[model samples]
Target: MDSNKAKNLEQILESSIKDPKDLTRYLYYRKKLKEEGLSDFISILPLGAAINWARANSVWPLTFGIACCAIEMMAVGASKFDLDRFGSGVFRATPRQTDLMIVAGTVTYKLAPRIKKLYEQMPSPKYVIAMGACASSGGPYTQLGYQVIKGVDKIIPVDVYIPGCPPRPEALIDAVLLLQDKISKTIPQQEAI
Candidate 1:
């Protein structure tokens, strides 16, 4: 369907829903469909939907782990956890070649500059996932250490923050999936590297 038709249909649906939760759910799905470049009539047909699906499933995260959390990040890629199932097991060594950056450890003041540099190297519409307590908030060293950054976000814009001293492999997988969901909803501004 055309954009105008889709908008009319959305208005009808929004007006018909009285319950707040149901309306919210409806709006969320509608937004998801729109992000994928689909309308109610075109959703069944695969055009724009296929492109978004491919983008969502084929996220290549840069291999840039720093501290103890790096070990957990590795575990997620191991056969036992199998991050490949999420289509994000391939960790590119080059920042220029990847879309997702998983900062899986502590970021000290000294390392913040390098992190920011790497983030800037990533192509447009890139994403960062802060994947540990230390990376997210400096963990136990938040107050005591002057060298450690309170959070990686101080250096780069973090899209998802996973809270754990060193989060379990399962948590990393969940974070990747969540990042995938976010990617699916976004309209890429540039071609994938």
Candidate 2:
């Protein structure tokens, strides 16, 4: 069979196989085709854009809570605020499984290295939200305390900074929405011709 026919057959086989690994590989190729602008024939399904939209909406956050702000962070997941509405209420316990890392408390100098390690463990395209004054700038400890790190950004690259000793749940929700907006605007990398 010609290359195009062979590829089509492979896609069909993969789709029907019911194996998670095969499905993942098929999806990867589909994403590549869309990125190269070679998927006009498949325009009926904007798979690439749909994938990006799904990713932006369903951001799974890593669970990392350090101090008082941790309380506020938890509050965001409670029913009253309903962070699930934004598709980010599910907090993953493992760094490898999450795309967002919320630094929700004060970071001490001793813990900075550990936090950095955790951030490094996360996969690429991951985001970090510094979720309180303590996490953003060490709160009352900034410059005055010897043990507290001035900011979480010093340890890991922070994407958003929510200010407040312990920011209201609504503020956290706003930060998440802003992150979703940022995620939605990202352009997929084009494959080299």
Candidate 3:
């Protein structure tokens, strides 16, 4: 069979069978072997389960706030919104101590380097959340502003953008939840080869 057919057959055997039409020549044989009790399916189950768990609850965030929107970010960190519900309440000031950088205000030209440096300081598996329109895309200052850097994403890789002039605390919570969803979709990091 061609490489494409082989790849499809492998996918059929590994994932849901979908239908008889979904199975290619190789998977048809594998199904017959399973009916005859030839091979075990439990062998790779542990790794698959570990991957699912890793994708669910492993998020850390850095509280990197500047300008006015920084206040809203603080409110999210406070009692009402309780960012801990998303497992990201521990607002680490240093980038080295966090995985997600919550860009919570206007990123000025001078501050852009600091933002980039902090992003670089983070370990592997780092993520960023641009909180507010200012942090996301310059907001009211977008019309030819000299000092404003527009968006935090220009300097650092932003994984989620929470849009608003200055997003409410509830909006910030939603952004955190969105970040959680993104976290859930990421491939789990594997052990070193």
Candidate 4:
């Protein structure tokens, strides 16, 4: 199929498959097509933009809370705020399964290396969100605590920085939304060619 036809088909499928189960079936079929040695078929499909859109919408965050801000992060996942609406509610236990790492508290000098290790373990196109002043720039500990790392960005790249001693849950939601926007804007390398 031509790229335009593929794009149209993708749009139709997206519009038709609102249920999660239907989406899963669609993904299965796509995987099957790829496994059948259909490189040309896959290349012509608008899989680049479609895959990025899927990644942006369904960002599975790593469950790695650090401090007080971690509580606020949890609140976002709770009933009142309902982060599931944004498609980022599912928190994965392992770095391998998670695409987003929300560093929701302080990063000390000792923990910096471990954090970097976790970041390295994550797959490509992973994102880091510095979700508090402490994670962003060591909050109250910058001057007082000699052992605290100044910023998480120093250890691994941070995509979004939400500032507060312990930012509100709403701020965490906003940060996730911002990260989604950023991810959606990314052009897959294949599309660049």
The top-ranked prediction according to TM-score is 4
Greater lDDT among 3 and 4 belongs to 4
Which of 1 and 3 is ahead in lDDT? 1
Task: Compose the digit string of candidate 4's lDDT tens values, residues 1-193.
Answer: 6999868756765654457886777777777877898855564324455777788899999999999988888889999999999998899999999899999888998898899999999987799999889989888889999899998999999899998878888888999999987876676665343
Question: What lDDT tens digits, residue by residue, belong to model 1 across residues 1-193?
Answer: 6999867744644664467987777677767887887665554322333456787898899998898999888888889999998889799999999889999888887787888899999987688899989988889899999899898888788899999888888888888888877765554343441
Which residue pairs overlap in candidate 2's backbone?
Answer: none
lDDT per residue (tens digit) for residues 1-193 in model 3: 6999857735633553334554464456656777878657522222333454454455667766787788888887788878777677777767777777788888898887777778788987777888889888888898888899788778877778888888888988887677766654444555621
| RMSD (Å) of each candidate, 1 decimal | 9.2, 11.2, 8.3, 10.3
The candidates, ranked best first by lDDT, are 4, 2, 1, 3
Off by over 4 Å in 1: 1-48, 190-193
Quote model 4's TM-score: 0.74
Off by over 4 Å in 4: 1-45, 191-193
**TM-score of model number 2:** 0.73
Task: Give lDDT per model, in order.
Answer: 0.80, 0.82, 0.72, 0.84
lDDT of 2 by residue, 108-132 (tens): 9889888889988998779999999
Error of 3 at 34 (Å): 21
For candidate 1, the clash count comes to: 0
Q: TM-scores, in order shown?
A: 0.74, 0.73, 0.71, 0.74
